[model samples]
Target: MSTLSGKTALITGSVQGIGLAVAKVLAGAGARIAVHGLADAQQAEAAVSAVRSAGAPDARFFDADVRDVAKIEAMMAEVAEWGGADILVNNAGIQKTASLADADAATWDAILAVNLSAAFHTMRLGLPAMAERGFGRVINIASVHGLVGSINKAPYVASKFGLVGMSKVAALEYASAGTRETGGVTVNCIAPGWTETAIIEAQVQARAEQFGGDTEKGIADLLAEKQPSRRTSAPEEIGELALWLCHRHAHNVTGATIPVDGGWTAQ
Candidate 1:
């Protein structure tokens, strides 16, 4: 069965964008959702409701700021008591655009804290139990920047690159934790390039207005220089790949940094 029937999925930054999209797909596969994010009461509730409606046996939101290690530890303890994160998706991330010389200390700290260090904490807390159980899936939401780079995004690039490196270490460490019968412990990254998320909506809107409100034209124009496919991936597309990885068939697909970047990395 392609079902995570008795599993619990803890997805960070799941209130919106790729995180939320991933949550819904896992829920649809019958996994219970342990939602985490920095969202208001209304938005958090909406995320839980969305997952539940998508087919989760249950869906509950865990409030925690990923940038804070103490908060993340507290949330992990709570999740352990509830059950345990059978599948952990480190999707919470923050980005700021700045030149290498211009990037401030605080900005660098915040970006690394949320994007890289936070995943370290969660994996440390969650992977042991998974190893004991002989099954787990750790999906880190990295970026195309993890594999390459561009201008005016020093900290963001550094954080993503760090994430990619860290995930490889995790993958190798737990590569032999399970067998064919069990799904096995796997750690992987989804390196998405210019997906249609709120993160890029402002840019899209600005370009769309410039092109007489033709959003398609705006998207095409924005992706022209980079993404060879010239179309941004839908958030749901990323979610679908995450779901595929969670399936038992993908047990051997550990340590992979799969790109849904419309061929950006291919170049």
Candidate 2:
């Protein structure tokens, strides 16, 4: 495990689910934490408290509606007051399950704004400082859907694919800068499979109900159909990978989209 002592990490949409899990993992490794999430002051504070309990040297929360560029910019500026984040995790996302014909334009635009465009806005603002400092980590949390398409997920797939493409471009631009003076900032994305988060739990429950309330069968059927491993990933597993990517040893790894999808994409 790499120690992130003295470093600051900023993760967006971290009040719950995978985002919160990542925050806790990074905090446990000794990083100061800046948690950004939607506008819920109580939830935001609880997130900060979790980070603190996880042993982060320092922790704070910033609430903003990431779809609003102005609000995101304001929040970033506030975080900058504490000398900017050394690691940036673009983990904020929204999902809509609808076919192309069934999906409305408003939902598509909303998904894109939150899932794809917000990452772009944050990266544009956050990467400069990392480049100047010469050491940074930018991890975008994409999904298996980014690599392969799925039914009823047109908008989500589109946004994630765009995110992956954007990550590669940023990686190429910054690939040569991580030297002794420059802190070897690496840009990468993680495409997670069906994971055991609140989101997935809700999905499973819905599927279970659809199958006459057989929860285990619903889980088994879903995993058997898609993932060869026949299991869901733990949020901490994704966080651990994110932590590894932020380590100094991973400095040489950039512009890559590593899948933690339990062989979902392997097929």
Candidate 3:
């Protein structure tokens, strides 16, 4: 458990699900949170309140629609003015399921913009300061799709794979930026599969209903095709991994994409 006192974490898409979980845990470690996501007024304020309650010294919401470069720039500027991000989590993403033939150009563009390009923009804007400070962490929330191909998800899979490759490049670029004591800058990806987030709720619901309300069976059914562990990871579990990477000792763990897929990729 590393302390992030005086540190500021900028997590995109942090209003709910995995992103929110990351914010809460980082907040518990005394890091100020720069929460960014798309949500209504009440939900946005609630997100801020959640992190504060989780023990953040302070938390501010940034309304950045990551698909737009201009919005990301404005958001980064605001965060920079407040003291640039020490930890940048590229957790914002959008996904649409469609086969190659059915995947339209607009869908590809949107998915690529949010899932891949947003990370690039944020890192470009944030990493320099982290290098100057001699400490930085960029944790990208990629997917198992990054490691393997899946059906009816051409754009999503492409974006995740691109994200993984991009992180590797960034990691190499900044590998020697900082020293061990400074907790050197590092870029990494967490490739998660079948996590219990809203992203998979529809599948879960449909499966559960398919099995006559037998939720456990439905989950098993869903996991049958992959996920040998037959388990769905919780969002907080992913947060725990992110927190570990933020530790000073994790300075050397760059250019790595860790899988939390319950053996889905192993198959």
Query: For each candidate, what TM-score against the reference?
Result: 0.95, 0.96, 0.96
Quote the RMSD, in angstroms, for model 1: 1.7
Whole-model lDDT values for every prediction: 0.93, 0.89, 0.94
Index of the highest-lDDT prediction: 3
- Across 1-267, the per-residue lDDT of candidate 2 in tens digits comes to 338998899999888889989999999999999998875677878999999999898998888899999998998888889879899999999886878899999999999999999999989999888888889999999999889999989999999999999999999888877684445988999999988776577668878997899999889888988999987888889999999998887888999999998899998
Position 160, candidate 2: lDDT: 96
Error of 1 at 137 (Å): 0.2
Residue pairs whose backbone atoms clash in candidate 2: 134-182, 134-183, 134-184, 135-183
| Model 3 per-residue lDDT tens digits across residues 37-119 | 99999999999999999999999999989999999999999999998899999999888777898989999999999999999
Q: How close is candidate 1 to the true structure, as a TM-score?
A: 0.95
lDDT for model 2 comes to 0.89
Q: Over 4 Å off in model 2, which ranges?
A: 180-183
Q: What is the lDDT of residue 62 in candidate 3?
A: 97
Q: Report the Cα lDDT for candidate 3.
A: 0.94
Residue clash pairs of candidate 1: none
TM-score of 3: 0.96
Question: Which has the better lDDT: candidate 1, or candidate 3?
Answer: 3
Model 3 regions more than 4 Å off: 206-216
| lDDT (Cα, 0-100) at 66 in candidate 1 | 86
